[model samples]
Target: MSSRLSSRRTRAGAVLSAALVLGSMLVGTALSTQASAAPAPDVGIAATTFADEFNGPAGTPVDGSKWNHEIGDNVNNHERQYSTNRTSNASLDGQGNLVITARRENPGNYNCWYGRCEYTSARLNTIGKFSQTYGRFETRLKMSHGQGMWPAFWMMGTTGGTWPNNGEIDIMENVGFEPNTVHGTIHGPGYSGSGGIGAAYTGPRFADGFHTFTLDWSPNLLIWYVDGQEYQRRTPADLGGRTWVFNDRPFFIILNLAVGGYWPGDPNASTPFPNNLTVDYVRVTNTPGGGGGGGGQITGLAGKCVDVAGASNANGTPVQIYDCNGSNAQRWTRSGNQLQALGKCLDAAGGGTANGTLVQLWDCNGSGAQQWAISGANDIVNIQANKCLDVTGNNSANGTRLQIWECTGGANQKWNAAV
Candidate 1:
C-alpha cells in the first residue's frame, strides 16, 4: 500500500530529468546495485500522490493542525532543551531553508518522565501529520557540531503506536563531533541502529555545508544517496518486519535535534550548545506508470475490451499484459466475480499458498479458483495465487516472461489495473 516516489515536472518541450531507478546508478566500480526496483508511481492512488512543502509560496503550508510538533522529550539523544519557535532556536529562511539552532540555556522545560531541558535549541517532527505512501523525499540542509549534538530528519510508522514495530527511516542523521560523515538507516523489528541495517555516505562534512539527501522507495527494495551518489542497497530481509508493516500502513515525517539518547551519548562541557540544522526545502514528485509494470497501449482487442487490461492471448500462455483496443481479444465478460477471457478461468498455479506461485488459466470451476480483486487503484490479485497478475517486473520489454510467484510488493504487482 505504501511506496517511495521520485519524479519532476517540466514545461512543454523541456527535457525533464528522468528518475534514476532503483538499479539505475552504479556506485564505486559498478553501474548499479541489485536492490529491487520500487513500484513505479501509481498516481491513481490518492495516498501515493504529490506533496507541497510547509507554508511556502510553492503551495499550502502543511496545515499545522495535521502535524504535531514534538518538543521537551529527551527522546534518545541527551543534548539540551526543545523549542519550536524560529526565535533563538529554529526558523524558516524565506529563501527555502529550515534552521534549527542549539544553544546553551537554562534548563527551562521539564517533565519528570525524561528530565528537563538545560540548554535551549530547536527540533521539529512530522510524527502526527503528513507521510506519503511512496515518493522521493529530499532535503537540502546544513548541520551543527559538538559531541552531544544529534540532529536528524526521519520518518516513523503512524500505526502500531511503537518504534521498530512501526518502522523508522533516518534519511539524515549526524553528531556534533563527527562533523564529516553522515548516515542513513532503517530500524524495525529485525534491525536497529548499530546491530540494525544501516549505512552511511561520506560527503563533505555535512556539519559545515548543505547537501541533499534522498531515498528512492520502490516495491522491490530501498536505495539511498547523498547528492546523487549511490550509497546503499537493501532487500526485504534487511528491511525486517517493517517491510510488510511499512507497506501496509501510512507513515509520517519528523525533523528533530535530540540532545542525547541511545546512539550518540550524553553531551560534555566541550560540546558546543548553539549549533544548527538548516534545511533549504523539501520537494516531492510522483512517478507516472503505476509502480512495477512497464507501460503499453491497448493493442488487439474486441469492441473496447472491459475488465481486461493485462490478459493473455494464445491458449495455454501464462497471463500477460496486453493493450486494450475494444476488441474481442482484450474484452472479457464479467459474471459477478468471474472474469472470462479466452474461455479459460484464472487460477493459481498448483493452488499453492507459498510465495511466488505461478498463475495460470484453466477451465473455470466456479469455486474460489476464479475469483479476483484489486486493492490500490492499480494492484490486482487472484483469489487463489494471492499473487498478482504482474507484467514481469514491469519491464515494458515486449515478450517479457510472465511467471507467478508469491507477492513481494514490487512494481510488477501493480498492473495498468483499471480497478
Candidate 2:
C-alpha cells in the first residue's frame, strides 16, 4: 500500500446525526460487528517466501532521528478534523514501544507543515530517512476505539510526493467496529485508497493487546504475514505496474491511528476518545549476494530439494532451477522455506553429478536419500549423503557429473543465478 485519506458544521452535523441515528438504529448490529462489510484485497494471493526472524529498531520511537510528525488530509481521506500534534499525536514509552494518540481538541494553533488544525490524533513516519528497500518488516500493535478510528501499520516509497503513484503497502489496518480483524493492503497504479489491494484476518480484538503483523518482501513478491503465516501476495503486475515499486526504490514505515474518514464513516458518540496505536517492535532482514546466487533462507516441500551434504553449485553443466511447481519432484514442505529437493535437485557432489548418473526427478516419498538443500548464496548440499552435488570428476563435460560428493568449496560450489 502506498500513501493514503471527512465532513461538516452545526446544522449539517444535526442532519448528519438524525439521518445516521435512524441509519444506525436500523443497522446497529452491522455497525457493531462490520466483519462482512469490510472490502477484499486486490490479487487475493499470498507469498511463496517469508522471514524466519526480523531486525529493526526497538525499545522506543526514535524521535527526529527516525520520523517526523504530520497532520491529516495530506493524502485526502476527507477528514474535517485536523490531525494535530500534542502529547496525543505521538510519543515513545522508553519500554520499546510507541504511542500515537488522537484527541478531540480545540484546533492546533501552532504552525504545522500540513493540514488546518482541528481535533484528532497524530501521524508519524519513517520517510526521507530510515527507509528500507526490502526485508522482513513487522510490528505488534493495539488500536483504539471510535466509530471513526482507523489505525494502521503501512509503508510508502522513498521518492516522496503524490499518493498511490509512488506505491504503498498496508501491513495492518483496523477500523473501529471490527477490532478483532486486521487488514493487509497495497496501493499503486490501478489500485488506490479504498480501491487498493487488501485482505483481512480475524483475530482477538486488537484493543486487547499487541499482536504481530508482518510483510516479507523480495524481488518478485510481497507477502502479508499474520503472526508468521502468509495470507496475501502482490506482484508488480497485480499492482498494475512495470517496476516492482516495493523492490525498486527505498520505502519508509508509517505508524498512525486516524479518526473517522469517508471509508470508516465517522466517529460516533459511543466511540472512545484518546485510543492508542501501540507498537511493540519493527524488524527487518536481508538476503545474501544481492539478488543473485540465491540464499534468502527459504525452505521448500518436505525433501523436495534435500539429498544431504550435496555439492554447492560447482557442477559444470548449469543446473536448471524451476519454480517449485508442486510436481512430484518439486514439492518441498517445511515450517518455513528450508528446502530438500527430490533427488538432490540433482547436481554432482562437490559440483559433480556424474555426467551419465541419470538426473531424473522423483516423488516426495520422504526418503532422506532424496533430500537436499541450498543454504546461502553458496553451498548447495545434500544432508542425507553428507556430500556436495558435484560435476562428475570436475570434468566440465556438457553431459557429465550430476552426482554427489564431499564439500571442497571449489568452483563447482559457486552458483550462477541471482536470488
Top model number, TM-score = 2
| Cα deviation of 361, candidate 1, in Å | 52
Give a tens-digit lDDT track for model 1, residues 12-67: 11001121122221223321121453442332222223332333432223335544
- Lowest-sum lDDT 10-residue window in model 1: 8-17
Each prediction's Cα RMSD?
Answer: 18.9, 19.3
Predicted candidate 2 versus true structure: per-residue lDDT over 125-195, tens digit per residue: 76565667776666656667667778887877766445555677888888787867878887765567556
Q: Where is the poorest 10-residue window by lDDT in model 2?
A: 12-21
TM-score of each: 0.52, 0.53
* lDDT for each candidate structure: 0.50, 0.49
lDDT (Cα) of model 1:
0.50
TM match of model 2 to true structure: 0.53
